[model samples]
Target: MTSRAAQEEGVQFGLADTGNSIPVGLVTGIAAAALAAGAALVWWMRRRRTTRG
Candidate 1:
């Protein structure tokens, strides 16, 4: 019984790890795009405010 439980636990742990495996390149690209978009938005807002004021 103990051996069976250990085997099942190991299988579950492996599946969990694999489920979280994401491509690093994809993650980095998304982060870079979001950061660039945020910066552009801030710059636009500040420029608009300055022009109005």
Candidate 2:
């Protein structure tokens, strides 16, 4: 009985850890995508202005 409880607790902890990892991964991915998009927008604006001028 105690063994089963311990096993259950371990599984719960593992699942929690996995769940935490997913959010961190998602946040990092989002930040990277935002940075890339911002850089692209800046580049496009600069190119357009230079071409016009």
Q: How close is candidate 2 to the true structure, as a TM-score?
A: 0.58
All candidates: TM-score: 0.66, 0.58
Q: After superposition, how far is residue 6 of candidate 2 from its true place, in Å?
A: 28
Off by over 4 Å in 2: 1-22
Candidate 1's residue-wise lDDT over 1-53, tens digit each? 47679788774433434535788889899999999999999999999999999
| Candidate number with greatest lDDT | 1
Q: What's the distance in Å from true for residue 32, model 1?
A: 0.4
Identify the runs in model 1 with alpha carbons over 4 angstroms from their true place: 1-4, 8-15, 18-20
For 1-53, candidate 2 gives per-residue lDDT tens digits of: 47679788774433433455467878899999999999999999999999999
Task: Please list the C-alpha lDDT of all candidates, in the order they appear.
Answer: 0.83, 0.82
Error of 1 at 2 (Å): 3.9
Among these predictions, the greatest TM-score belongs to 1
